[model samples]
Target chain A: MNKNASRFLAGPYIIWMIGFTVIPLIMIILYCLTDGDGAFTLANVAAIATPEHRKALFLSLGLSLVSTLICLVMAYPLALILRKRNVGQGSFIVFIFILPMWMNFLLRTMAWQTLLEKNGVINGILSALHLPNLAIINTPWAIILGMVYNFLPFMVLPIYNVLIKIDDDVINAAQDLGASTAQTITKILIPLSLPGIISGINMVFVPALTTFVISNLLGGSKILLIGNVIEQEFTKGSNWHLGSGLSLVLMFFILVSMALMAKYDKEGEGTAF
Target chain B: MEHPLIDLVNISKTFDNTMVLDDLCLSVKENTFVTLLGPSGCGKTTPLRIIGGFEKPDTGKVIFDGQDITNLPPNKRQLNTVFQKYALFTHMTIAENIAFGLKIKNKPKAYIDDKIKYALKLVNLDGFENRSVASLSGGQQQRIAIARAIVNEPRVLLLDEPLGALDLKLRQDMQYELIRLKNELGITFIYVTHDQEEALTMSDTIVVMNQGYIQQMGSPEQIYNEPENAFVADFIGESNIVPGTMIRDELVEIFGARFACVDKGFGVNRPVDVVIRPEDIDLVEPEKGTLTGVCTHLIFKGVHYEMEVTTPDGFEWLVHSTDMCPVGKQVGIHVDPFDIQIMNKPESEDEEAVGVNE
Candidate 1:
C-alpha cells in the first residue's frame, strides 16, 4: 500500500513542477522576446539596456556586493568566536540575529524607519546628548545596514558549522610544529574554512541583489534598485515582459557567481587542516 | 658520564580532584629509547604530554638539558609528539606537512627542502611530496607524521601509540622500522604503549605502570624474569600466581606440597605469593617427578601448546610446551627452584611479626 501511494505521489509532483515552474519560465522567455504592443521582437530586451535600467542594474550589483562584503567581515569573526567559546551565549546571540529575521520584513523595515527618522529615537537621542542630528534614513548606508542586519545569519551559520568540525588536533599539530598562532590560522584554519565562506557569500549576495523592502522603507523612495525596478514594471506599469527579462538577467548573474563559488569549493578541498 | 637529556622530577597532576600522576619521577639519558608501558588509564600518555609541554604538571619540574621547561607551551619545548591518530593535516600536501616546522623556524628554502627530503627518506616515504594526505594509506600517513615531527630535529621525540591503528602484521613491521629509525637518528625517544611485547622488543628501558603509579622500571629481561609485584608479573606476561608459605630461605610450601625456590629474607615461615611462568614449567611422566597433575585443557597456539593441569591438591597450573600434552592425561610438572618468584603477602599478623623482628 505504501509503495502504491508513493507511486501515486511521484506522478503529480512531476506534473505540478512542470505546470507551475517550468511552464511559467517558458512563457517568461516567450514574453521576453515580445514588444510593448505584444509582437515578437527583441525590442523589449533592448529596452532593458536603456540608461535608466542600466542604472538600476548597477545599483543592485553595487549594493549586493557591499552588503555581502560587510556581512562576511562581521560574520566570519562572530562564527569563529562562537565555534571556539561559550556555545550557549553563541546560540543566544544567534537567536538575537534570527529573531529580527522572524519578525515581518515589512515590520523590521518600519522599525528601522522609526529609529532613523529626523524626530526618531536616533535623532532624539543625539539631540538629547547635544550632538548633531544626521540625515540617515534616505541614504545607501541605511539600505546596506538593513541588508547586513537581515542577511548576517545566512553568512554566519555556514562558516560556524565548518569551523566547529575542524579538528582541534590539526591546530595543535601546527603549533607543535612551531607554527605560531597567526600562521596556524592563516595557513590552516582559513583555507579549511573557505568553503563555508564561499557558501555564505553566495547565500548573502544573491538574495540581497533582489531584496526591495528595506530599500523602500529606508531609502525613502529615492534609491532605485533592480528589484524595485522589476516591481515597478510588473505592478505599476503593467509590463510583465520587461520585469521577466530583468529577472532572467539577475538570475544569470547569480548562476555565474554560484558556479564560480562551486569551482573555488572544489579547489579548496584537502587544503585545510 | 654526561647528564641525562630529560629529567621529570616528582611530577604530579590532578584533574577534577582525581590524581593522574602521583609524584612520578623519571630521567632519560641521551639517545636512550624508553617505553612507558601500561594499561589504559595508567597515566602513561599524560606523562608524555607533560614532557612534550602539551600539559603542565601541578607540582614538578621538567628539566631538559638542565633547564626548567615545566611552564613552556608545546611550541617552545624542544620535543615533538607523534599522536596515536597520526594527526596529519588533511588539507596539506605531504611536502607541506613535513616542511611545516621548517617553515615556522624561517629556515632557508633550500635548507627546508633538504631537511624534508632527509626526513622523508628516513621514514621511507620518499617521493610522496605532492600527494595529498587523504590519499595515503594508514601506514603511509603514519610515516608522514613521523617525517613531520622529525624534520625539525627536535631533541626528543614522543610517540603515543603511533602504530596502534595498524593491523597486527603491519604493527610488527612498523615496530622494526621504528627501532631502525630510532637507531639511525640517535634521538631520545619516549614511547607509550600497552603492548608488552612491543615494549620489550623496542625499549632500552621499560617503565611498567598501573593505576597511575609506576610498578617497575628495568630492562626487558629484568621485567619479564623478575617482576616486582603480582601486577607487574600479570601485566608484562602470563603467570600462574599461587598462595604459598615461605617455609625456609629457598623453599615455599603451596597446597600441602613443598616447592624449592630462590627468594629469601621474608622469614623462616611467612605467607607469600609465588609466581611461575607457564613456559618455565616442564612436564614429565606422572608419579616420576616432584609434583603430579592431570591435564584438563589443551589449547594449540601456533608455536606452542598451552595446557592447564589440575594438581592432586586441586590447584591449577599452566604449562606451555612445543609438544602438545593430551587432555585427560596424568602429567608431572617440574619447575626449577629459581623459576619461582615469591613476594611477601601484605600485612598479615605473621608478616607483621616477621617485619617487627627484621
Candidate 2:
C-alpha cells in the first residue's frame, strides 16, 4: 500500500474549511466593499468613526482587556498548584475545572445573573444577614464578571498543560543553583510558560471582545457594545454591508492578537488545549 | 577530630508502601570523591537527594559540618547538584545559565562576567557563552551543567549519574575529566552510578548498595580483593565461586580434593563459599598441574583469551589466559594459595549478588 495515500483523508477537512470558513470570510469582505445596488463605496466601513460606534469599540476593548488581565492573575496560581500535585491528566480535579464547559455557556451566564440580581438567591441570603444587595446585575461589572467566569478555564487548561510538561528536574536544578522559590518562578517557570500565557490571553481576549450575548443578558440591551451594534445592524437594521464592515474592523483586532501569539509561540505548543 | 563534611545518619525513606532506603548511613569526607554504586532502584539516589535537600528522610537526620540540616530547603543548602539529565535552562543562553547563582546573589556585573568566563573555561567551553542550551550536544550540555554547578563554589557537589546519556567512549573520556575537576576544584563530590569501572576509576571511596541496604563501603582495592560475602564477590568481576568445606586452619577442600589455602577462622568442616578470579588461574601441562580439565569453549577477548574448562567431576571453570587452547584439549589449571578468597554466605535476602570491580 502507498503510505502517502493516507493523506487524502484530509480532503473532508479542507472542504469544510473552504465552505464554512474561507467562503464566509470572502463573502463578508465582498459585502463590506459593495453597497446594495452593487456600487462601490467606502461609506459603510468609514461609519466606524461615528460617535456611537466609536464609543462601543473603545468600551469593548477596555472591558475585554481588563477581563483578560484578571483571568491571567487568577489562572497562573491554580495551574501551578495542579502541576505540583502531579495530578494525572484524567484526574477528577481536572474534570471539575472542565465540567462547566459542558454546560451551555448561556445557561452559566444566566445563572450568574440570577446570583447577582437584587431578589435572587445571593441577595436573599445577604438580606437575611443584613448585608447590602449586589446591584451589579445590570452594570458593566456584571458583564465583566460573566466574561471572567466563562473564560477562566480557557486560560487555566492551557497554562496547566504547559506547567505539567515541565520536567521536575529542571525545577530542582534551579533550586540547586541557589535560586529561591520566587526567583525560580520569575526566571525559569514564567519564561518557560510564556507560550501558554500568550495563547491564554488570545483565547480570553478575543471572545470577551466579540461577545454580544453576555452584555445583553447582564449589562442590559441598553449598553451598546461594538458586538451589539454589529448584531443590531444585521438583525434589526437589515444593513448587511454595515454589519460586514464592522465585523472586518473586529477581525483586525483579532488578527493583531493572533500575530502577537505567533511571535511568542512559534511552535503552537500551547494551543492544544 | 574534625567532623565529616556531610553525614547521612540512619536515614530511611518509603514511597507508597515500598521502602526505598532502609536505615542507611554514610559519612563523606571533605574534598574527597565518593561514589554510590548500585543497580537501578537499589536506593542509591535517595541518599543523594537527601543530601541535596530535594528529599527528606522518613527518619534520621542529615548533618552538614556538624549542623543538623535535615529540614533545610535545597536553595538554602550549601550543596549543589548536577542532575542526571543536566537540566539546563532551555530559555537562557549558556552564559546566563552559568551566571544564575551569582545573579541570584546580586553580584556585581564585572564579577559575574569574570566568573562566567572562568567557569566556562574550566569546563573547556570558553566560547559557548551565547549559544542556547538546546543547541549543544549531550556532552556539551553535561559540561555546561557541571559549569553551572561548580561556579557556586559549594561545599559539596552531588552528581546523580551525570554521564548516563553519553556514549561509552565519551563517558570514559569524561570520567577522566571529572577526576581532574574534582582535583582542581577541591570540593567534596558524591557521584551515583551503576558502572563499576566508573566508580573504580574515579572514586576514592565506593559505597556498594543493594535493596535499600549498604553491602559494603571501602576503598576500591578492599572492595575488589576482600569482599565480605558471596554477593560482593560475584558482582565485582569474573569469578569462579564454588561451595567448599574448611577442613582446618589454612586448609580447604573442593571437588573432593584436599587443597592447602591461606584462609582461616572458619570451624573445621564448615561449609563456605570460595572465590577465585579468572585471571589468577595459570595453564600448565596436565601432569604438572594441581587440577586437570578439558577445554570446552574458547573466546578471544581484546586483551586476553577466555576459555571454559570442565573437569571430569563436572565442575565448570572460567579461565582468562593470554594463549588459546583448542576445544576438547585436555588442560591443567593451577591456583596460588593467596589468590583464593573465602567468604560467608549472605545471611539475608536483601544482600545477595552485589559486588563489582574494575
Candidate 3:
C-alpha cells in the first residue's frame, strides 16, 4: 500500500476523534471556567471546595479503593487456580465467572437488590433454618457485594492472562531450588504477575468509582456517592455548572490516579500487559 | 565404601496412555557426572524431573543419600535443577537470583552474601552480582543458572539441557567449565542432553535411551566404540551398519566376502548387523584393499575428509580420512577387526540396514 493511501484511510477516524472526544473535553474545560451567569469566574471552581463535595469525592475514592482491594483478594486465587489446573474446562470455568456480565447492568443491579432485600431469599433461608433474621439490604456491604460481582471477571481475566503465561518451569525451578510454596508465590509468582494485577485493579476500580446504579439500587438511595451527586445536580437540581464542575473533578481524580499507576508501572519496569 | 548419592529404581511414567518413561533405573555415585543422552521424547528429561522431585514416577522409589524421598515435595528434596531456559528470576538482579535458594532457606545475610560471592566466582561471574539478569548475554545467564543451583550445595544437581540454548562455541566452553565446577564442588551432577558430543565430553558415564527405555549405559568410549544395539550405535554417532552373517566365532561374511571381527559367541551363519564408525574405516589404494569402492562424494570437514564410496557390491560406505581423497577415485576400505560391532538385525521386513561403504 502506498503511504498517501494509508494516510487518507486514517483521516476520517482522526477527524472523528478530534471532533467527538478532544473538542468536547476542551468545551468541558471552558465550561469549568464559566459561571451560571455566563461570566468567567473563580466562584464556580471555588464552589467545588465545599465540605459536602469533598466528602463525596473522598467517599468515591475510598469505595473504589476498597472495591479494588476486595477484587484483588478474590481474583488472585481464582486466577492461580485457573492457571494451575491445566484442565480442558478453562472456557467453561471462565464462562461461569463471566456469566453475570452478559446481563444488562441495571437488571444485574436490581437482581442483587432482590437477593439482598430484607425478605429476600437469603433472609427467607435464614428464617426457615431457625436462625436470627439479618438485614443486609440498603447497606455499604450490599454496594460492595454488588460491585464485586459486577467487576470480578474484569479483575480475573487480566491476572489470568498474566499468570497463565508464566513459565511453569520457572515455578518448578524455584521449588527445586528449595523455595517453599509460600515463598515461591510471594517471591516469584506475585512479582512476575504484578503488571496483570495492576491492570485488573485499574479495570475494576475506575468503573466501580463511577458506578451509581448498583450503589443507589442496593443502598436504597441513602448512601450518596460522587456519581449520585453528579446525577442529582444534572437531573434534579438542574445545576449544570455544579454538575460540570463535579464531572471535571471526578475526571481529574481518575486521571491523577491513572497517572500515578502509570508512573509506578514505569518505575517497576516489568511486564504490564 | 560410600553409597551413591542418588538412586532411582524402576522409575516409570505414563502420560495420557503414552509411556514417557518405562522401567528407568539409574544410579549416580557421589561427586560424579552422569548424562542422560537421548533424542527428544526419549525419557531423558523425565528422569531428571523425577530426580528433582518436579515429577513423580508411577512405580518407583527415589532415594537420596539412602533416604526414601519418593513422596517428598520438590522443595523438601535435596536437589536443585538448572532448567533448559535457565528460568532465572527476571525480576531480580544477578545477585538476588543467585541468593534465591539461600534466601528460601532463611540463611543469614552475611552467609548469603558470602555464598553468593563464592558461587559467582566459581562461575566466573563475580563482579556481575548487581547487574540485572535481563541485560546479560545468554551464556552469562546460563552460568547464573548454574550458580543459582549450586549455591544451595544440594546433594544432587540436575541440569536439563542447560547449554542447549547456547551457540556451539559457547556450549563447548561451558562443557569444560561444567566439568571443572563438578570437580570443584564434588556434587552429583545429573546432566541431560540430546547432543551426543556434549554427553561424550562432560559425562563420566553416559546413559543412552530411546522410546522410553534405556538402550545402553556405559562410558563414552564404550558407547561410541561398542554400542550394544543398532539404536545406540546410530544415536551416539555416525555409523555404517551392514547386514552380515556370522560365519564362525570372530568371523562374519558381508557382501560376498568373509571378514574377521573381534566379537564371538554367535552361531555359525547367523544374521547380524555390523557397525563401524567412519573414522575406524581405513582407506587404501583401490587395488590393494579388502573392500574396494569408487569414491562418489567427498566432504571436507576441516580436520578430516569424509568420502562416500560405492563398493563393488553396490553398498555405500562412509570413510573418514585426514588425507585428501578426490571424488570418483577408487579406494580400498579396511576397518580394524576389533572396531566392528555386531548386533541382531531389527525384526522388521521394511528395515533397511545402513551401510557406510560409500
Candidate 4:
C-alpha cells in the first residue's frame, strides 16, 4: 500500500517499456534517418512518393476503409440481435463468436485461404451443386474479406457491451413517448451507443490498415499493401531503413486514430472487456 | 355517470407460472388522480404498464376511451409514463428531452418550441432548455421527465412511483406540484406507489392492492374510516385489529367486553375483526373506561406518544395519545362508537396468507 512499494511493483513494466517500446522506436527513427553508408539521408522516407509505394499506401487505406465499413455494417446488427437475446455473459451465443478467436490468428487466416482457394471446399461445394466455378482468391476482395473476418469481433464486442448497458427503462420511456421502433433506434439508441461505435471502428480500422499477414496469406504476392511493402523491405529486400520509415508513417496513422479514439471515447465506455 | 376514461376489465397476468394479477378490474374517471397503491410485487405496475401499452393482460381487455387497445404497442397508445427511475435520455438536452414526443409526432418546429416552453414552465424549470440531462440533479431530472411526458398532451399520464426517489420533503413538495399540474392540465393521472400517506394525500381514488388483488378502492376518507377487511385496515394505518364477536345490531364483544358500534350487517354471535385506530384510543382512569391495560412500552413519536398497552387477555393495544404514559402504568382505554369499525373475521390462515403473501 505504501508509495515506495507500489513504485517497485512497476519496476519490471518500466524496464520492459524502455527496452522494447522506447528503444525500438528510437532505433527505428534513427534507422529511418540514415542510409546504407550510415550517413544521414531522407531518401528512405521520401520513397513513399514513388508510384509503387503510393499505390500500396492508397490500396491499404482503401481496403482497410472498406473492411472497417463492412465490419460496422455486419457487427452492429449482430450486436443488437445478441443483446436482444438477453442471454447473459458465458452464454453459448457469445462462445460461438469467441471460439474462433481461441485458435491462432495465422491458423484462422490460413484456414480461410484453404476454403477460398480454387477447387477449395467452397468451390467444391459449388461444383457439387452443379453451379459455375467461383473465384475471389488472390484479389483485393479476398484481402478485405480476410481483414473483416479477423477483426469483426473487435467491432461486435464493444458495441454489444454498450448496447447491454443501455437501461431498459430508457427504451421503454422512448416507446412510451410515442417514438416508433425506427425512431427510437435513430434518436436514442444510435446516439447513446456512439462511443462504442467509434471505439469499435478504431479497433477494426487500425489493425486492418497495418496487417501484412492477412493480405499475404489471402491475396498472395500479387497484392502489395503498405504493410506488405514495408514487410518486404525488412524481410526479402533487407532494407531496414525503408521498412522503418514506412512503419513510422504507419505509426503516424495509428497515433491519429488513437487520438480520435481519445476524443470520442474519453471514459472508455466502449472497452470490450 | 359518464363512461370512465379508461377501463381495465377483468385483467389477469401471470409471470413465469406465478400469478401476478388475478382478474383485476378498475375504472378511472377523466381529469382525476387514481393511485394504484400496494407493496412491491403486488402487480400495481402491471396495470400501469398495460395502460401505457408496455404490458398486455393475459386475460381481459384494456378499454381506453371506449376503444380496445390491449394489443397496441406503446408507441401507438395515446398515453405516456413518467417512469419510476425518471428514464430521461442521457444523450439529449433538457429541451430535447421534452421535445422528444412532439418531434416523434412530427410536430412543427414552432409548435414544438411553444410546447417545450410551456412544459418547462409547468415544471418550474424555465431557462433549463439548453442544459444537458447529465448536468441536472435527480429532482431536476425527474421534473424534466414529467415535462417530457406532459408535452405531448396525452389523454392519460401513468406515473409509476415518480416521486419514490426523492427525499421526504421534496416528495411532499412534488406531490402538491403534481396535483397542481393535474388540475391545470385537466388530464387523468394514474399514479402508483406503496406509500400509504402519499396515496392518502394525493389520490382522488385509491385502489389498495395486496398479492395482485384489489383489497379495497375508495376515497381516502372512506378507506381510512371504513376498511373492508383486516388487510385494508392493517395496510392503510397502524390499526389495532383484535378478534371479536358480533353479538347483535350496534354491538360487538371485544376482549370479553361489549362495545357499541355502528356496523351490524352480520346477525347473531358471528366472529369479526374489530378495527380500532391507535390515535382513536383515549387513555383515562381505569375505573372510568370500558377496558383497561398496563402500559407495556412507550415510544415518543414526533408529535404524539405511542404507548403499547397489554390487556389482561394478552392482546396488546397500540395507543397514540398526547399525554405520556409511563411504562408499567395501568391505563384505561375508551373508544367512541363511530371509531369502532367491524368486519368479518378471516376465514382461514391460508386465504389471509395468500392475500397478503406474508
Which numbered prediction scores highest in lDDT against the true structure? 4
Candidate 1 regions with alpha-carbon error over 4 angstroms = A1-16, A37-40, A43-48, A86-110, A122-135, A267-273, B312-314, B346-358
Query: Candidate 2, residues B311-352: lDDT per residue as tens digits?
Result: 888988999999888899998888888888888765655444
Sort the predicted structures by lDDT, highest score first: 4, 2, 1, 3
Per-residue accuracy of model 3 over B1-358 as CA lDDT, tens digit each: 7688888999989989998987878888898889999888777899888888888899989888889999899999888899999899988999999999888888999999999999989999879988998799999999999999998998788899999999999999999999999989888889999999999999989998877877789999999988877778878888888889999999988887777788989888999989988998888987667788889989899999988989988888987889878888888887768988888776664233321112
Q: What TM-score did chain B of candidate 1 earn?
A: 0.94
Docking class of 4: high
Poorest 10 consecutive residues by lDDT, candidate 4 chain A: A80-89
State the C-alpha lDDT per candidate.
Answer: 0.86, 0.90, 0.85, 0.91
Docking class of 3: high
lDDT of 2 by residue, A96-129 (tens): 9999999999999999878887798999999999
Residue pairs with colliding backbones in model 1 are A270-B91
- Tell me each candidate's TM-score: 0.90, 0.96, 0.94, 0.98
Q: Write the per-residue lDDT of candidate 1 for residues B1-358, one digit (tens) a residue.
A: 9799999999999989988898999989999999999888778999998888778899999999999999887888888989888888877899988988888889999999998889888988888899998899999999999999988888899999998999999899999999998999899999999999999999999999866677789999999999877778778888888888999899888887788888889798788878899999999987766788999999999899989999988888988899888999998888899998987564555323222111
Candidates by DockQ, descending order? 4, 2, 3, 1
Q: What TM-score does chain B alone reach in each candidate, compared with the true chain B? A: 0.94, 0.95, 0.94, 0.98
**Superposed Cα deviation of residue A48, candidate 1 (Å):** 4.7
- Candidate 4 lDDT, A225-256, residue by residue in tens: 99999999999999999998888888889999
- Against the hidden true structure, what lDDT does model 2 obtain? 0.90
